[model samples]
Target: MDSMIKTGIIELEEMEFYAYHGCFREENVVGNRFLVNISIRTDMTRPMQTDNINDALNYVQVYNLVRTEMQQTSNLLEHVTARVMDSLCRHFPDIEWLRVKISKMNPPMGGQMRNVSVTLER
Candidate 1:
């Protein structure tokens, strides 16, 4: 018999917020709907065996961190996404990999685009 370590991914998807993040002044003032998604990869061996929240990555804490980052105004989606990734990595030292996506809905680009999004992975 052999013991194997398992890798697990915990994903938080489509978390929505109304934030003032944009290049335009009107966008900063009026704000817009935004969606955030995060995926974190970590060792799942302990959590799988013990079935304990403490042994696993806490999603509530993840969400709070993402929310805090989103609340800070930024002009670029890339910057926001990077901030989220940085914050997550800082808070969770055990993370093997992380992916973050930020989408701005109905952007003021003078076109009929649904949304503009930025993604960062590390």
Candidate 2:
């Protein structure tokens, strides 16, 4: 008998954080709510067959990485999102594709908008 190879998508969605990130001085001082979402495509064969954490993408580690990056203050959501994407790629070379999104809730745009977001996919 032979095992089959397969690819799978893993997602961590709506990971919330309260971070000080913005272009305006007041916005930074006041801080705001944020959401980080990530999607990863990778080889799932080993993890599926072995049913072991070592063979799979450790999402807890991924969440930690996102949290670490979010804690680092930045002037823009784009920069934050990019840092997350870069960190994940650097740490997990096995990922076939990656997508990262950062959302700033109730942004200080002087309007009733829900949120502003930046997304990067590769």
Candidate 3:
């Protein structure tokens, strides 16, 4: 068996966005902050040698896609994550696999705690 190349971790933190996504009525109307982190597995065999941007995955475009998707309204974080994964796979065919984590900060819960996040893969 041959070992595949890894592109390491790519993270985007504190990406604040206002989206109407939640089960509660106020959540949809009021909206909240969201943070997204994406990890992509790319075949770096060529880029390592050529040192070309096109040879490897373009992460900036991927981040843009995630940002655009997060702007839309959705009922659940799972749905948003799935959409992100699908979009990423469609845009970047070189990616063998991807992990997307969507976080909803300061959820309507009455407790003082960190945000809620959902991770999905494709």
Over 9-101, each residue of candidate 2 has an lDDT whose tens digit, in order, gives 999999999999999998789999999999999999888888899989999999999999999999988999999999999999999999999
How does residue 107 of candidate 3 score in lDDT?
88
Which clashing pairs does model 2 show? none
Superior by TM-score: candidate 1 or candidate 3: 1
Q: Write the per-residue lDDT of candidate 1 for residues 1-122, one digit (tens) a residue.
A: 12476887899999999999998999899999999989899988888888899998999999999999989999999998999999999999999999998999999988899999999999
Every model's Cα RMSD, please?
Answer: 1.6, 1.6, 3.2
Higher-scoring candidate on lDDT, 1 or 2: 2
Error of 1 at 113 (Å): 1.0
lDDT of each: 0.92, 0.94, 0.81
Q: Could you tell me how far off, in angstroms, the CA of residue 70 lies in candidate 2 after the best superposition?
A: 0.1
Candidate 3, which segments miss by more than 4 Å at Cα? 1-14
Question: How many clashing residue pairs are found in candidate 3?
Answer: 0
- How well does candidate 2 match the true structure in TM-score terms? 0.95
